[model samples]
Target chain A: MPTHNRIDATKVGDVTVVTFTDKKILDEAGIQELGAELFSLIERDNRRSIVLNFDNVDFLSSAALGKLITLDRKVKQAQGRLKMCRIKPEILEVFQVTKLNKVFDIRDEQDEAIAAF
Target chain B: MTEQSDADVWRRVIDLPSERGSNREVTDDLLTQLKVFGWPPSDVFAVHLAVEEAIVNAIVHGNKLDPAKRVHVECEVSADRVLVSITDEGPGFDPARVPDCTAEERLEAPGGRGVMLMKSFMTRIEYNAKGNSVVLEKRRT
Candidate 1:
């Protein structure tokens, strides 16, 4: 149901790496599509481990952050793990400022995130 | 110091319909203008994030995503600072009363984080008496 060019998903072993291709994830439709697609992966498809790579996203809205929080909660409830990697420094500054860096598992590289599992 | 006229500064004023995709378009346009003005990437990132949060709050929280309402954005970019004001036509609420999102109990609550993020990224923030309008300012650092 998440029909959009905003996100690209790939499987690296047992991990689903969802890289956001959009420079800005501000539109409600794209944000919703992302949330839906990730939700389906964990809840329906039963993908236990996920890594959201933000290497390409230069901008994101609070709505999108809120959606990520929801997805993280869903993953935890399902006993799955969710990690984020390759977040731009500007974006990572947001997580640090909000203290969300403590809430989620974030890494500096995709390989690091994958190895954590 | 001599006062500079409005023409001396880059300004963008938009009265947008409370539509879903309006925030993205406005943000893109604002960032482009800021970039053209030669703002540092770090400063641009901060201002961009703050503006996005402010617009989303105005459209979603203040106006409740009602198409009948309108959101007004005024952006003024200068060599030393960027000032952006967002006003929504809706029943305003007190920003002071917003619960702290950084608190342990409220971290997971989807609300208040936008306000927190806006306050965090912008160097100076102020709300109007009615609380329907917010101004975010960031001095080049």
Candidate 2:
């Protein structure tokens, strides 16, 4: 229920759908804020299923990817599911190059991610 | 980067404190020059990622965010290509020793992906013998 500067969170049935507000998630301060908000969904609110909608993000650095890796572990430790959707092809290349696409549950659309959970 | 030193193109050299957010101004300036020179968005994105990751490595891993230390960045932009070099004032490590972050066992780790990402995105990436400095280059084709 807190006001988040980096993302928008809403509930879809049992899944909490989060949308990134920034086009570029590069700066360290912004990445830290993003990681904190994401961790809070499971650590503070105990939301079990989460979908990160990336339609708005045009660019994201490795640091942002690092935060996602940590967030994925946090979600898994809490017995929750995490999925990411709507990644731009160029941005998706980053995941593929890093082989993180294999690690994350990435779908082509938002509804697919929501339904998967 | 020296190849374009005498050519007519957008160029800049900056020295900044080793800390968070210091790369933004230089990065923004480079992005603008690339845009004006007609580098497509996708190509621009690649340069952006490569540059951001390299500078951050210089500031965080190389300089350790030491206020006494400084990170130097040199950039050049042209219609044909863009080149960037980042150097940090700290005892350097070997780039060859950075573990492959994409390895199966290390996939879950949060860090160590920057170097690999830089290589994948940039056309060519080279580290100094001391590893305290890196040069990232991309040629538009």
Candidate 3:
């Protein structure tokens, strides 16, 4: 298992449950590193059924959302599933305002997200 | 928008290189002021998000990360409101032409959502005709 500075990825019955290492995902350089770390789960590790737990992330910029969008695309191309759980209400509003809630598989809890897979 | 009252004072005005992280100082000041003035966390989040997006757009999209250019940032924060204006030295593009990121076909696209998020979070946003400058405002709620 590769060590990731930007995220903590653990396995829950073959599903990679990932949580961020940053409270605020705003900086461009940091966001790029985060995106790369996430993409690696699918591109390099070839893991399927991923759930991104956003319990600790209190804030994120639109650029971070872009990376998640690209990651979702990559996971789909790899025939893996990507789900997001535990997004803060304020951060969740960002998703709703952008109408990305419809595009993403968002669940209320990590167990729910994992069960959906 | 042209006239400023006694209360409308710009707290910080900076000319920064068009580098990726150059907006940090101004944004840091704005966020700190908001919190120190007792703005709620949710409101702080909105203001912070809008300001970050506008400055990043100025550096990345408008100035194209040209170090030769600069991003002029003017920010004002008071008890009731926060205002920030950012202008880039690039050949300005048309904000109207930016495709709707929410449109069905473009929903999956990664780019082009910054402007929308800025508009959504800021209480009001105004762009100069040349589109190189943007003013983001948020009122205490």
Candidate 4:
């Protein structure tokens, strides 16, 4: 069995800050759960901005990236925004390689990511 | 008759759905298992990426979203290395035909980085001729 990683979310002002504590996010089940959770947050709270804090995350898989992309599209469709912060170098490389850096607003710090809204 | 000695080998098998969403949980579990087996953070990350790539390919391309089909993942860990094998039920594709992610035109593509990440992180990678199976190994220092 794979590790059970934790994801925590809190509201800071009008933005929803989601923190991923999982070191690795791979496979389909985990991604689906995460996607559903994020979507519910957006739908229930009417939040216009999202700050995804990856401070404890060390790696992310393409499957995970796909979910993020889906969330990004949803956020944009709602005229809200999704921002990523504290991405590890390795994970950041994945974003760069996939050219998702251009698709989502990414920052090096949580404060910067939140302030971008 | 000689007695067989127990060696420090770790093994696990996981059933993966053909859907793309299950990839994250399996990968997280696998990485945690590796860490419990004493792999360093760097080695764990590398193996994790390689495994993700293989599983993604198996689900997205090999199985083609066939929910009835399943992907099998196996991992073997020794004192100094780890080996991961992923097998899919669908007919495999030619690994050679896969576009190089580093190529100029495809560099901007969002999905092609899986193979590149697997190659870059693992010590060795090989695909069976049927393309239904991929085996990856990472050596821990």
lDDT of 4 by residue, B1-141 (tens): 111113677677777788876666656666766776788877787787788678878888889889999988877776688888999998887778889866667543445667777877889989999989999988886
| Chain A vs. native, model 4, TM-score | 0.90
Question: Which residue runs does candidate 3 get wrong by more than 4 Å?
Answer: B1-10
**DockQ, every prediction:** 0.69, 0.88, 0.83, 0.29
iRMS values for every prediction? 1.3, 0.7, 0.9, 3.6
Lowest summed-lDDT stretch of 10 residues in model 2 chain B? Answer: B1-10
lDDT of 1 by residue, A48-88 (tens): 89999998898888788888889889999999999999999
| Window of ten residues with lowest summed lDDT in model 1 chain A | A1-10
**How much is B24 displaced in model 1, in angstroms?**
4.0
Q: In what order do the candidates fall by DockQ, top score first?
A: 2, 3, 1, 4
Model 3 residue pairs with clashes = none
DockQ, candidate no. 2 = 0.88
lDDT of 2 by residue, B11-47 (tens): 8888989989888888898998888888998899999
Indicate the TM-score of model 1.
0.91
How well does candidate 1 score on lDDT at residue B116?
A: 81
Judged by DockQ cut-offs, the docking class of candidate 2 is high
lDDT of 1 by residue, B1-141 (tens): 122336448777888888777866667766777777788898898998888778878888889989989998887887778898999998888988988887888777655677888888889999999999999999888
What is the DockQ (computed on Cα atoms) for candidate 3? Answer: 0.83
